[model samples]
Target: MLLDEASIRRESEHVEDHIKRWMTVEGHFRILTALSTQMTQDAISVAKTSPLVSELYGRLLTGSALLQLAQSPIDRVQCSLDHSGTAGTLLADVWPGPCVRGRVEHAQSTQAPLYGGDGNIHVSRQPARGGELYQSVSPMHASSVAGALQHFTMESEQVITFISLATVVDDDGQVTMSGGLFVQALPGMTDEDLSKIKGCLAQAEFEDLVVAGDHPFDASAAIFNDVDWIETGTDPILYRCRCSKQAAVGAVRTLSSDELAAVRAGATETVTCEFCGTDYIVSAVDLDAS
Candidate 1:
């Protein structure tokens, strides 16, 4: 039941379409969700451990990664959860175009404090490399998936009024579904308008809605029942890897001349992408050409 490239593209389009439809103001806010039982199963299969641990990792990774994309114009994002399941790191990039990158790491525990103190969700945002257009972090006391994201929006430099995020991993570890909703107030929005929107979002019960609906759009519609919104555009998102044989050869070229000679004397060198587990082989002739 593994998803092929075509299937992955289809799912990506579905999620992107929903997000685009939920947009109200241009670049002011964004809502995105992704659901993939096959991808979840594939991710957990790599662990080969307890179902509980695998499920937890898959859920957190999916939720946090989606939230990261909601905050910036990042086209690619990667997240790595700690072995203990209490901490993780997120890396985001725009890749090939402008090449902006940022990283955020967080740990939560009473004894080992990474950010501020115990039970304090201390998150940090590294400065963007290419431009200063995107740089912000939200640190709050709540640690749940929804709470962390809400804090992220509230603490961002953007004028975000409300955000709701929810994720559910099936009990049997067979399915993973995640939904995120973002609401931002444009310039000149009055305090009264912000307050009303916040009140509506507070009463939305987005978590329950996500669990009940079969799709991200359904969940979003339920969350913002009274808001007037329309479909704008779409962008596809998939668990894709930016790795290839040429990239592998370039990597080998980075080694010292002596190392390259040694590699030439041996078998072909194979490089594996850590993100998507794709392997690329570089032959001796390829290295010689470089």
Candidate 2:
């Protein structure tokens, strides 16, 4: 759902972490700006990832949130990256609540650049009303999650999209800032108009946007100071997991029967939610009841 200008202003002022969306008066450029400080902190706290992985995870979360803005309010979006590198894989989900959750696996090297590996970006959208799932995968840009995501959207959705993402973490392994912006060429967009947006982004740069101010207004005004645009919607970026005790136990049941028997022999099996790090137990009684 789209928020009115009043809600947009209220949310932007009250929420430190949220995504703000807009379209140009010319109807040629669709834009989204995100600031995800609290969201990143929540994800990092749950993952307990190394500083490098935390940064990568934060970017993935931001990317997912941006993509979600393109979806109908009822839809949910998920993005994943699997690489042939020591850095490992990343997964993130964004839903109608504007909340995000994710996980990273097989991180063999904290120093390993998130790039320099054969990797693919996979994306999918789930219809809230229940329907066939939409999925696509594209080669990774490797340079950054934002690059890969931009490539994926352009190639898979066949739209010209310019995206830039960034994550900043302190020496204490705390995420101080995390977010980015994307300008997508709409149906009526002309090459010149697209170029203008690109040029604006090039001049503004992600660094300057944040340096001047990380607020949505500050960044949007910095990048499109002379342009006319109206707020389309705004939603707070929250970190919430869908994991439940039943879902957790159901996951444990997915193990092979032999494995299940062995786990049940212990009388209790602990299952951890990958997204939020919550734990659930499957006792012998639970198995017998099942």
Best-performing candidate as measured by lDDT: 2
**Candidate 2 residue pairs in clash (backbone atoms < 3 Å):** none
lDDT of 1 by residue, 138-227 (tens): 344454544554555566545564445544556564445654555556666666656656676677666667667545556566656666
> Which ranges of candidate 2 are over 4 A from the true structure?
1-15, 106-108, 211-216, 249-266, 284-290
Off by over 4 Å in 1: 1-18, 21-71, 74-140
* lDDT over C-alpha atoms for residue 10 of model 2: 43
- The lowest-lDDT stretch of 10 consecutive residues in candidate 1 is 107-116
Expressed as tens digits, the lDDT of each residue in 23-51 for candidate 2 is 99999988888888788888888888777
True lDDT of residue 74, candidate 1 = 44
* lDDT scores in order: 0.49, 0.78
- Checking candidate 1 for backbone clashes, the offending pairs are none
